[model samples]
Target chain A: MPKVGMEPIRRAALVQATIDEIGASGSLDVTVSQIAKRAGMSSALAHHYFGGKEQIFLAAMRHTLAVYAAEVRGALGMADSPRTRIEAIVRAGFGTTNFRREVVSAWLNFYVLAQTSGEAGRLLNVYQRRLHANLLYNLRPLVGDKAEEVAQRIGGLIDGIYLREALGTKTTNGSKATAMVLAALDLELGQGK
Target chain B: MPKVGMEPIRRAALVQATIDEIGASGSLDVTVSQIAKRAGMSSALAHHYFGGKEQIFLAAMRHTLAVYAAEVRGALGMADSPRTRIEAIVRAGFGTTNFRREVVSAWLNFYVLAQTSGEAGRLLNVYQRRLHANLLYNLRPLVGDKAEEVAQRIGGLIDGIYLREALGTKTTNGSKATAMVLAALDLELGQGK
Candidate 1:
């Protein structure tokens, strides 16, 4: 007696569960049974929805990216100046919804998966490209001819912070991470002034 | 008959083989048998020497750090200024011995392993602390009191670049990575002028 739209709901739950499981395990060695149990469903049901562990993890990553895209769009929409736009984009990286331990662990695993999986690699490239484009757009007004270089530098900083936090070498909340990036931004953009 | 002094040579070979296996696998999902086979030894011998994959990987990491330490020391010994010293350390990151495909892959795996393994975490922290200390020492003369902040940013950039190259998101050689970091240094130090 499942509803017509219940499948989507269940899939979303399973994806979230997969992220949680990976985070709890601190690795990508999660099992379908563990994810299914976390989602309050049977392994058979989870497999029915996502096929296997890789599919579930892929869906989780897609969900992560989609949320990130929306967050960036929302942040940019509210920004009024170049500085604010840049800050908005940078802040979006450490947004509460995306910076949880579970999500961060999932991100680390995603990068590792990207090394060997074509689909994961493509997703990562898209994410990087969009981030680069967004930063360049915001930076062009501030740095003139140096926008590309500045954007790449800032992009690397953001990724570096994320990578460090994701790997547990650094423990920082959103504000601290945001401050570090903004400091770099200040050095780069402030110098131009 | 085995020689009495063959242990060190065998251990070094096993460490190199471990790096090779991890690089070829593109993940730490490699087996002890695979590593042993790469070293042209039996799994039992590898186990006898290192106990397990974790111990073997730790020995490999220690070896990587030793090489990096020597490179930085050598580069520093011949340096003429703080700028050159900073450049030397940055260049050391991409040095031929440290930036090879095998070594870089091992580095990436080390970061992932750090998230779940305390030993790995300690090793990473030591590396970070030493790098930070080194950068701050070199930056203090150029930027005065702002050296610490600047050093952290530069360290993050170096790590970000390494992560990108290791993950195949970006492919850059030693000179290119050095130039990118020097550009950041120029921005920070140039602004002070």
Candidate 2:
């Protein structure tokens, strides 16, 4: 007896609103009312969709991860070689859509929340495992037996760049961040010109 | 008429308590009274010493940085080569004293706080600049023109390891973290066997 498509649109609105609210506040001290207001919806609707702040936050994190996954997939799809695949994955990390200030702030909070929340922790683990596996998959063809180590080192470098960029301490761009990763790659694979 | 030397001890206690509280709570939701209680003092005494929670957190951060700086000094003192110096610096990051659960939590929150805090941001910049400069200094003799890039890469790797270990997602030891940096080093300087 209720609207079907409206739920997805409403849910999506709440999720984006959660990101904006957390980003604007730069902390997880956001309220359901605040997010609801940002989404141009009633608090009751927001609550009905997400249940609580933690749930709302969880949903937002899932949305962020999904977008990131899609970007990585798109990048991988365009690649024909291991090197290009690696580059694509690295580039996706700092791509325009993934590197925005609000999203980075959301990521910072997500990292903090994962420290205490089991659900957040599990979500983080899944993302990290997937990233590591993907890197290892492509790296194995290029580095052979050292693929695991190379993947970890590369993954660490990417994370380090992301964390620094997210903190806004060292100014960097997508190309700059990607360049660093490639430098590490060249070092590992003897690919430097 | 207050006891001489009491202020330093009291202030140090509050800062340590702040770290402990943040570590225990895994977030910045800690109250001033909680920190004061952990420090075995009244909230009024803590306020007298630090002005408020922000100042208290700032002091805690300054204390953490000071301790890190001291470790770097000690490590650099025992260094015999550029490689050793780099090794010492990397080891210092994952050293038991600095890599404690609480200190890392404080660091994660500090990163989050820096996003919106000019003071926090500046402090982080100073710390990062010093670290980068130190790495570059040791790396120049070994890698020449590429030292700047290599230093940035190594610095990023160390940070990545610390950030990962801090999140408690993947358990890594000091030597392991240091070895990863060294692996990157070998890749950079072609020193890998």
Candidate 3:
């Protein structure tokens, strides 16, 4: 029999391993065996846990999203104003843990996966809706009626920066990306006034 | 001889077929036979022309980019001012031909392909550079020293809008997408003044 209460630990290791593997490959063209090896476990065990490669990838993304949500919640908790709250949300997006090469690669691949996978599509919709809601919620106080439009632009900018960074065409680090979005925020606020 | 002046025509059909195939499936997980059959040609002949699926996809993107460049050039020909030139560029991106659901899907897949394919990466880099150059050239008179930064933000915004639209999270059509980018352009210009 297996050790009791070990499922969560093994699952966490597999999720991290999946992200590392996808990052190294820069695409979804990875194998279950490779991920299993990276996690220091057997393929059979990995399959027993996650069912298949797709599930493993989905699980990794879930973990990544959860981490990102935690970061945003933590940052938002300390923000004193509506503008700062927006800033906190933008910074959380480009935070170190969320903006790593592997994490970004996973995001790009996930976007692609959402194209064909229904489950992925639903998950992505949830993320997009949550992001839009968060931006709109804070932006309401500042932009008032223009909050929806401004939120869409900010959300689009964040996603766009993430997409560009994943391509690695430019050496835009987290802080640089954060600054760019913040500048956009300033422009929106200025225009609204 | 097989036929006179048929090479270019055959290649065009194959490229269009590739785009349609990728768009229909929404990923690169497609087969050469499927593309060939859709193009109304045999897989053997398709291989004779493009060598493989990857080459066929590269050709499809080349055609897409060429069409986009032509659209931009055509629009710029009638543009009366620098701001109008910027508007022309933004409008061309979200124009009907370039912003079709199939074409956007192809673009998203191509971005994913760039991660693992050197040629795709180079092609994407060329597209990115040309976009930056075009934006900077026109933005110079308007923003002066801040042209590069403004251009970068505009480029990122364009990309972000495309990414969001591809996911189909919101019902943002081409005109709507174009309007969003133009608004960002306006904000940047206003802030630079």
Candidate 4:
């Protein structure tokens, strides 16, 4: 439940804080008290804004999907031709941007939780499948007859980079991971890293 | 502390039982009394096998890693060409072997526990980093000049699929993923379901 007057701003702020909390570390269960303290508001106010932690988590995760969808759309703007657009779309997953750190952190944390045994994991899996379907639909023309396969491949590639960065155990950086996949596609990308 | 009759086989048996217990879902901590019950032996027999659950867990995790490492090596043997070997090696992480299932479950559980802020998490992180680094070293020859970049790509791909499959949500089988990747590599693969 939201106060009718402050709904948009309050909701945005809650989701933003959620992303910041998860991004600063990993997405653990952030308590009502912790979120309230961080927001400079009462726990009751936080609850009123987002209902509860689950609602807040879902909002933050969905907010990230929206952000990336917009970026992918914008990146699609970088080139008029389909081949170049596909390259831009692939690069979008790896390029340094303001959202890069937070996105990668959120991305890794998302998949980590997705591996667990429960509702949270199932929700994440559903979201990813739907998201990839949309991406495949978007890239269908660019990939010609093999759009579905290409979409999964690209999703896996983006997922692979997010996994590496989140695991923080891999020896190479985001750019390196991006370059190899691009090279494999023979998409004529310059050495990014 | 082991009893007088403690033997390596007995110790291995105890660890194997612990692995199944953990795999099937249960609290890992046990009195030697419980291990004896699980093993259908006298309490003294459990005492003879090993010191306790901690030892059992350590050995289980080590066994998991060793098994995965061996599977990886075997998968790499199935192909003659560099590209073929790389594809096979990637499949190793998503293989159909019994070892793949057990090792994935063990590693996934360990990884989740590792995310918590504690000694267990740190230990898992350090050990996995070493293993991932060693895995990358094996890909050096196939990658040639772009070894580091290629390693990052391939390593991330392998772990990404493992993470998804371990969850048993996104990927129920590896064939589709394998085909998608093989297609991306320009290798002709059988149709995916």
lDDT of 4 by residue, A1-193 (tens): 5346776776787777777776665545567667666666677888887877777777777777667667667888877876677666667666665235556666655554544435556667665676576567666765565666566666666666665565455444556656666764443121222
The per-model DockQ list reads: 0.56, 0.64, 0.66, 0.27
Name the better of 2 and 4 by DockQ: 2
Candidate 4's residue-wise lDDT over B34-102, tens digit each?
A: 655666567676654555555556666666656666876787677776666767655765666632444
TM-scores vs. true structure, each candidate: 0.94, 0.94, 0.96, 0.68
Output the number of the DockQ-best candidate.
3
Q: Residues B79-140, candidate 3, lDDT per residue (tens digit)?
A: 98999999999999999998988889889999988999899899888888888899999999
Give the per-residue lDDT digits (tens) of candidate 2, residues A1-84.
466778888899999999988988889888899999999888998988878778989999999999999999999999999889
Per-residue lDDT value at A140 in model 2: 93
Question: What's the DockQ of model 1?
Answer: 0.56
State the displacement of the C-alpha of residue A86, model 2, in Å, after optimal TM-score superposition: 2.0
- Per-residue error at B52 for model 2, in Å? 0.6
For residues B3-30, write the lDDT of model 1, one tens digit per residue. Answer: 6987898899999888888887888888
The TM-scores of chain A alone, one per candidate, are 0.94, 0.93, 0.94, 0.74
Off by over 4 Å in 2: A1-5, B1-5
lDDT of 2: 0.87
**Candidate 2 DockQ category?**
medium
- What's the CA RMSD for each of the models? 2.1, 2.2, 2.0, 6.3
Write out the backbone clash pairs for model 3.
none
